[model samples]
Target: MGLEFLDVFEQWANSYDESVGGQNREYKAVFAGYEQILEAVTERSMGHVMEFGVGTGNLTKKLLDKGLNVTGIEPSVPMRGIAEAKLGSKEIILDGDFLHFPDIINVNTIVSTYAFHHLTDKEKNEAIAKYGKLLSKGGRIVFADTMFESVEDYTNAIVKAREEGFHNLAKDLETEYYTTIPILRTILERSGFTVGFKRCNDFVWLMEGEKQ
Candidate 1:
């Protein structure tokens, strides 16, 4: 998978919250799902929480307001700066891609949104293993992003898009790699996590896993 999206994200960072997609119903639903994920994390363990790819502190600010100690990792300076301005010293936003961040052990909960798609399936599985080790017992992982149950599901979406006259959109979807939700569940379970998931939209889903 290409990281060209990073350049787009860099350009979109400052205006992300105000972008046209930001005002769409899909984005609103995803944001609601993010809140639910954070609420669930707080219920599980209020100790230490880290958000991978915490762009502009959208959910991070909510975490802080609810009084959970939060840390965020964001590679984009522009996005991180906006988050920093909103969060102040209430939380720390680390600078680096999440996989390379060395001090992640013993956290109570890990959350990420719309970011893991940047990783290939192999890399995503590697991350699952790493997250398994980083979490404390009974800790949880909360993720919200584009996920499908299988390749067929992904393909069907594309076909449906083309049928619905979204040819240009279908063309874009054809190029990206998305994690299969069932495969992700199996990987997390192998890493000792019991998982659950909910669909947020046609191509987006929210997943939760509790370390067992």
Candidate 2:
């Protein structure tokens, strides 16, 4: 699935937290209100959660603190190690990605933050379809990630990043498969979910989809 970015994650493992904490100016806007975003995702999640891309276990910790049973899946070894260390021995983070994960049972809510855009639109569709089949009625998928309102907005964001001399941010925007709202809505609805979106920050939106 998103394993192609494994090396990136591996390299980022040590600095991921700092980057999200707004220590890095280039990504500050991207991770603006990081704590609040994680809280929003945690608030929406329900029983037996499956968390994809549990980098450093930040969101995973929030879910656990909310008294929710969580299964964390991370593809990067170093990221998983850091998460394991952070979450301690009680929690087990599995090896997986958006499309491929261990056969987890009773995962009524799926939660992820700032990570789903690693998948291309086609892969995103496949992942959503897989989740649709796996979840029962009333189950949910709550994700917060960078997405655009339109193609024009997407283009403008990259241009703005470039103008601000955030070449890394600009390149990331250009390289990754960041998609638009309409596309995500279509995918979620087609997969039999009633979905809604709320802006979390300038670069992130919280997408909540309930299985129908």
Give the candidate number with the greatest lDDT.
2
Residue pairs whose backbone atoms clash in candidate 1: none
**How far out, in Å, is residue 48 in model 1?**
0.6
RMSD of each: 3.2, 0.8
lDDT of 2: 0.93
Off by over 4 Å in 1: 1-4, 20-45, 89-91, 162-172
lDDT of 1 by residue, 1-212 (tens): 22546675698687677642446342343344545554554454456788888888877877777788888888887888888888775248987675777486558888887788777777777888988888867888888778888889888877977787766447656765576987888889989999999776566677889988
TM-score of each: 0.83, 0.98
Task: Please list all clashing residue pairs in model 2, or write none if there are none.
Answer: none
Give residue 109's lDDT in candidate 1 (0 to 100). Answer: 86
The Cα local distance difference test for each model comes to 0.74, 0.93
